[model samples]
Target: MKTSDRRTARRGAMEQAESGQAAPAMLWRYYAVAIMLVACFIVLVWRVIDLQVINHEFLRSQGDMRTVRVEPIQATRGKILDRNGEPLAVSAPVVTLWANPQEAQENDEGWRKLADLLGMQSDEMVKRLRRHKGKEFIYVQRQLSPETGRLAMDLKLQGLYAKREFKRYYPAGEVAAHIVGITDIDEKGQEGVELAFDQYLRGVNGSKKVLKDRRGYVIKDLSLLQDAQSGADLQLSIDLRLQYMAYRELKAAVEAHNAKSGSLVILDVRTGEVLAMVNQPSFNPNNRDSMNPSGLRNRAVTDLFEPGSTVKPLSIAAALKTGSFTTETRINTSPGFLRLNGQTIRDARDYGTLDLVSIITKSSNVGTSKVALKIGGEAVFETFYQAGFGQSSGIEFPGEAVGVLPNFTKWQPIRLATLSYGYGLSVTALQLAQSYMAIAADGVRRPVSLIRGGQQGVSPQQVMSPGISRHIREMLETVVLKGGTGTRAHVAEYRVAGKTGTTHKVGEHGYADDAYNAVFAGLAPVEKPRLAMAIVMNEPQGSEYYGGEVSAPVFARVVANALRLLNVAPDRAIPMVAGASGSDSKRNGG
Candidate 1:
């Protein structure tokens, strides 16, 4: 066959193959692929619309749940200020560490590092985390410094967090601890004035929305839900100068005498404001990790004791009030002893005959009992009741005691005799001070005040006549003279009037034979009183346990400095009496 014929036949066959079913099949495959791509594009567009429009809010909310959070805004607590605007207690900024247990459970090594930083055993921290499993948040430690919180965050622990908070700080330390009181780690008041005024001192915390990173640290603040309101400042009537002076003297006396405890209270006679209130064996509010619970009491207002011979003047006042006796009234105490209802009352020695002034200066139990028997019980009870006995001191301090004063109707003959010399009844140091304060204010009883403006506009009750009060004041002056029981209580240049009291402390069995409470209560500047103070030394274990020996010296030292601090003028010009100097008998000084 010829080559040209074979080439023509082959070309014809190729043309037929291109124009046949193979061409249609290829075209159909291209059309099918284009249709499928269009369908996929339509479905993708519809899904985009659903996600961006219809489900937008739900999806965004889900995202927000992971990163956004509401946080508390810490409020600054109020400050407690002294009368002279000295800061007694304040709130300090601190950090509190917390953990998101769900995230924290993933990193054991990170948690061990946190445990070491927090001074906790790693195993204990693990146990705590296990106990709180599935919890979102848990506290690791509270009341840390900001530096520690920052260091903790630098660890990059997954769920560790830090919140701002406040802790209470006391500037006066143990000196004013009993008065200013203490607060817990959360800034809640636990004792003293802090407990009394907690509502006014604690602040209202606020809240805000914030955006946090994956590490549980705030990155941005979105909006504030509430604004924090700082607590109000509290102004107390306590004079820090006088408080320090009183505390120094009281603490020294408590230690020097080896006393179990001691309390000293100084009040303004005119305003009834507490100038100084101090207690021994006090705990430091700033550092309470090793605090003793026994030393936490404010003994001046909480503890009760018999006034002993300190109430002899009040008995004399009661007798004088009944008009049955005058400052010159005489009573026979020749035998120096009297038997009333099988109970014998005796004086320190035989005082053949005595005037009202002598009975008090001698602190004669027999003479006082005779006077009380003569006047009956009603007169004594009335004077005592009106003098704010057995009633709440208007200070309303927490744990303030209302001393026991039996009604006159319940007084027996022996009871009346014992009451004459401050027995068979109880009174707190504050109540005794208030009774003396009434005398200092010329028989006007004013409510005691702890706050600066606490007693404003309060009317003072006239408990005794002005003349009687003056007469009693003059009689009390002799008690501080050369032969008086309170002679040691006399200030160098200030004429003072006071009474010494020594009472047996009640024990678990009964009145303890050896344990005694030595007390000296007095007012200075006899002509016109300015300050009334009470000093009580509980269970002085030294040989000099008498009120004059143990408690009077304290009075002398405190009054000597306190009067000068208050700018009270000295009244040394007044002169009247001269008596032989001699040591008082066992019970003569009470």
Candidate 2:
């Protein structure tokens, strides 16, 4: 700092001044960095406060979206049981396979393996995968087998998932098809008893909230949702054994006669329970793919026809009820034909004279018309309506037809005469059976039922007088034993009473040229009647078209087997006819 000394002193002073200024500038930069660090810390604290308190619910909801889910809980449908509490229909578990199409398209081998396991073509499966690639969820197959479902999971088919569902299984198949009815793929009742009690049979569905892990497996039950209500069980009045017996006989008769269709129903005389109901050409509920509308029709209640000679019991009972005639009263049925209001009523044989009982026994149209004329239209119509004609039988099943019964005021003179013999008026097979039930039940008409233990809130209605019913029952007995038409319906060991009906099928124009509806209605053990039944065959195309030949045999065979199966004692001591003895009995009893 010498020569550089004098200058150095000033330079040093300058250098010290410059150093002081530089120090201040460097200090300012450091202080500025410290202020920036403090600002950043304040911003982070505000953000933490916003997340932990102010907007905490919104953030928490976002977190829950990944862990908790609301799932649908399917309710179980009701079980259908026979009278003996045997299960006719039950619900079975099934799995539905779904796919995430985008994921599926990425794994060709996985898709192929899934297709093979499901018994589907690989190319078709590929096309479906490609078509639904944009979709996040797609149904691959519904109602998959357990084995196939397991295989799909084992293969780890990309995007493949399974959901549990229920399917209805009918064990007895077509044997009880018409009675039990069937449900659709969605587990909803479609027809028959299933549809009738759908409200009770279909249970209430519920929902559940579940907590899940990242992998989508449920972790906690939460226990905060309503439980599903299972459907109520249905107990039908049908006896499985009796129904089978009736079905077999009716099916055989339909096949033997080459009939278009047929139906049969068995009713308890005292309780008014429908023990058996059968329809031919029925379809198995389990195999619905081949079912047709015709096969699904319940002919017993839906079909209506002219009741023919079967209407005689009602007419005769009416006459006896009003004191217009008696079992011993005789009428001149000479020439076996009578002309009334320009219409002719004829009989199978010319009986010059006959008593009240003989008229029903011979099934003479002329005799019946004469008796009906005595009772008059008002009385007959009232009796028929009271016997449950032109009205539903009140069975639970849907589509029960109320067969035609012309109004009393609308009856023409000729129409009145025709109605006496079950013509110009139509009645269902159920109505026909109920008419006879009144006679066997001693003038009481009970509502027909298909529910076991009897339906609640139903009571029997009085339709006729006890005295008239007893007399008519006696007259009907003569029709099955040593009488006309219904002789074939007589069971050898049990007293049976009934009438035969062979009516020409009515068409749009009028009665068909050759088509006929053969029908038979009867009660067994006339001394103490326990069961009443009716059988009807439509458009039978065999050697015989008469109710005696076509329908009565079916009634006899069914009644014989049903009674024997039920262990009902034989009211009369007589040898069993060939083929009429069931496997439970001997041709010659001990």
Candidate 3:
């Protein structure tokens, strides 16, 4: 029975397979599939047109509004500290007022109130508002006083807001102005150590995306792009106490002598650190009214002048190093006046067959010239160069002048003679301090430093033999004694050693008839020197322009205070030193 049913079923299947009635239904199925595909393509095209053309700009703006508010996170600038962590330059908070012009213009009453509080003319304020009609932000005023800032905020203008920003301030004021320098309104360094270490002193600003409401107040922070980092705190080698002392003394001397300008530098002989550097005509960093662009210069490292007799010890070093003379060697300086090369090199008085030791004590120009001739021109220039003359002191100071030493090939007889007495080549006050440091440190010149601990393990370069340096220092010690040129530079409790210099100022054409630079360079506690300093008084008036008179007294006062502050022990007893302490010849390069 099942076989017979299977045969009928097969016959039915074959019949259905061959049936023509199924054709239209299959065609209808194909048409339905095709229609569905066409409909999908149309929907895709419509969507493309909607996004790429119809709603492009609107969607873009909406996206930007949601994610693109830049909220800046203020960064604090670094503080500059002295060796003992005393604040030299610090950043303090100040208020800056700003406004959205469009919002403020919409609030006429608020704008009027703002104008009144800001002390601005209504017409001018209206004109400014018109100029920047729809601007998002503009500074209404910057660096407002705390009281003014509070009063302006009290007005509560629609778009006006007061924000805090750090402004640089110098607490040490004029006392450390030359070294600490000044910063601009944006807290960018403008001069001195501030300018030198700007990258370290300036901070990195940060910003983030923030959501703001209709009133322009922040709603939520979307994401932080960068985190603000405060600048690195700097520790300098300058001792604040010494800086104050030097500044006080230098200022007093400048005022007392009625000098045009003055510069003083103190160095630690043991480590080659600049302990103090000050200049006269200094401006207080705290008061902008006291600021003069000309007074802003750091003269200790910038101004160049012929070293005058300050370089006498260097000449002596040259003579000894060249095997031309010993400390006991004698030179005939009889009659004083030397005529050569249409120029005359003369001593104040004929020193008369003086030995090297006696020559230094007397500051005999003829004697120094004789030895310089004996050593030859090349030797003299080489000696000065080795002593850090005509070179940057490596103090990292901005605009530091490298003193001038003419090529030895161009030296004439007169040039060599003049150079012997420190009239031809030029040097800065800092250079003089460095050279004297060489003498104090046994002729080994180390790189001068402004950073604390920067001089540790610093290998020194030998510029002269220890023997000759010792002898030179010993002889210099005599210069501050009873019959020397720098007796006024002597301290009461220390064995002082130094040299005095007076050079006619070089004017636009030639040497000025009256203008002069009186300079003193010395090392204190000669037995074991601790500090080396240089002082320069420019164009001292009122009948006293000698280095010993104008600059040495400053040196004495500053050094005495500095030694005491450092707790240095006395190396010598107070002696009855007697001298006039005046320049020997008005016209001579003493």
Candidate 4:
């Protein structure tokens, strides 16, 4: 064998062995790649299963957390209606302009257009936009009218947006200001009836989670997060017609007499429903630009003053109820003065001898003091308490005052004597009106109601005997028909009965010099009493600041108009009387 041939054979054999190794390596590499691909496919399939089934809810929740949103659904406030179903206060649609200040600041044209539509200076708007650039949400303006809001939207200003809202509006303005009350910027009740019935007036706020588009617009409806409940409506007992009439008369009288302040309240004698309550210098609840503590005060329930001679009827009634005297009982009131417990009691003028009717009609301070002495302080105090003094009327208002009526056991001799004719104590106009209501309703005392549903199960209480109340009613009628104090309060078309009070203003030390509070309380249609009223004029400036001069005229006008407005048939055929010149000519100052 040749060496070349042997080498060639070995080389060929080596090449063959190398070829065999390369084929196996290539096949192994292919198999490994195939296994890796198959493993990756298996992992992908497992991940799909985990995400679509086992962890489906978790992924869905993450997606929702990133893209879903919830927003509040505001409910409308309840409506407030008068007794006649007239809308006194209502909610009207409004819009609020908001902005992403950072975005707005960068768009000068947009900012300028927005400023123009908002009635704001361009430079000022730019400054404000710059100031709030870091804030995510900023309110540019609120409570824009529908027209203005539409204009703003038309501008399509960058980052500027509008949200729909409801604003409370008072249609009657100041005419029913104190009665209807007012709401706050967030549509929440702030004062008056609004505050009193806030729970019923304020609706429940609901919410919803919705899917939105890229432009932040809500897409299809989603799940309801919460349900909204609308507020309940309120129907008050106030008669709008009577209220207007009373307000007009009270305003006129206040202007005529130059009174510092005045208040008038009318009540339904049978049901104790307050038909009209008015105070002068009232502010419009809608505007509220000129509102202050003084104008917002409800004097009918908040203010207190000495009742003076107006309290005489209560004393006389007490004496009569005790079987101490009758309408014809006589007492010696000559010299117009009497002394009891070392305190002297004096009348406006001397009346030597007068019967019970004459004594009450004349408003004799001396005669009333003598009668009170006979009735005793305990009885007088009890009578005043039973008439609803020294307590709230339970009306739904925030700052009602319980007027002072000192205990009889704590009264000194002078205090007792002064209290005989309405002094040394104080009472609100509402309290005085309630007293008259007691007489008009034949001795029953009903709780005053502001709401229309009759206040649960409460009923009137019999405070006095019917016989005594009738007798007192007759005596009070004589006061208006032929009396000394209530002559001007008599309405021509109605049989009226009332008492007058002209009390000196008390200072820190004692009574002020010459300053007086004139008050009058009365009822109309004495034959079948329907309404009772009380009026008070604080610090009336003029020579005729007596109750008969300053307050009675207002009372007569209010009663007359209220009766006509309420459609109460006139009980008497006499022409409507005015001033102090009537059948009764009592000059007692209340």
Go through the candidates in order and give each one's C-alpha lDDT. Answer: 0.87, 0.81, 0.86, 0.82
Give the alpha carbon lDDT tens digit for every residue of 532-553 in model 3: 9999999999888988778887
Estimate, for each residue in 1-590, the C-alpha lDDT of model 1 and write its tens digit: 79999999999998998789588899999999999999999999988888889778887888899999999998888999999999999998888988877777544597888889889998888888878878988999998998888888788777778888888889999989988998888888889899999989988989999999888788999999999889899999999999999999999998999999999999898799999999988988877787999899999999999889899888999998888788888999989888888878887788889999988888888889989999989899988888888899899799999999998898889999999898888988889999999988889999999998658777889988888888778787777777777777777688888888988888899888889989988987777898999999999996788887888889989988988999988887445357744246256636
Which scores greater on lDDT, model 1 or model 2?
1
In candidate 2, residue 365 scores what lDDT? 73
Question: Candidates sorted by lDDT, descending order?
Answer: 1, 3, 4, 2
- The segments of candidate 1 whose C-alpha lies over 4 angstroms from its true place after superposition are 1-56, 105-116, 120-134, 573-582
Query: Quick one: ranking by TM-score, best first?
Result: 2, 1, 4, 3
- The true-versus-predicted C-alpha distance at residue 427 of model 3, in Å, is 0.9
What is the C-alpha lDDT profile of model 4 across 1-590, one tens digit per residue?
89999999999999999998899899999999999999999999999999999889989998877668887878889999988899988989898888877556464587787777778898888888788889868888999898888888777766777777888998878888887889998988887899989989999989889886543545766889998787888999898888888898989888988998899889898788888888987988877677877898788888889889888888888887788688888989889877767766777678788988878777778788877877789989988888888877767577778888998998766677789788887888888898899999999888887777545577677767888888878777766654456677777788788877888898887888778898888888787889989999998897778887788888878888888887889885544334445322224454
RMSD of 4: 4.1
Using Cα atoms with residue i matched to residue i, what is each candidate's TM-score against the true structure? 0.90, 0.91, 0.86, 0.89
Predicted structure with the largest lDDT when compared to the true one: 1
Which model, 1 or 2, shows the larger TM-score?
A: 2
- The candidate that wins on TM-score is 2
Global Cα lDDT for candidate 2: 0.81
Q: After best superposition, candidate 1 residue 433: deviation in angstroms?
A: 0.6
Q: TM-score for model 2?
A: 0.91
Write candidate 2's Cα lDDT for 83-188 as tens digits: 9999999888888888877666554687887788888998889888888889988888988777767777787665777877889999889989988899999889
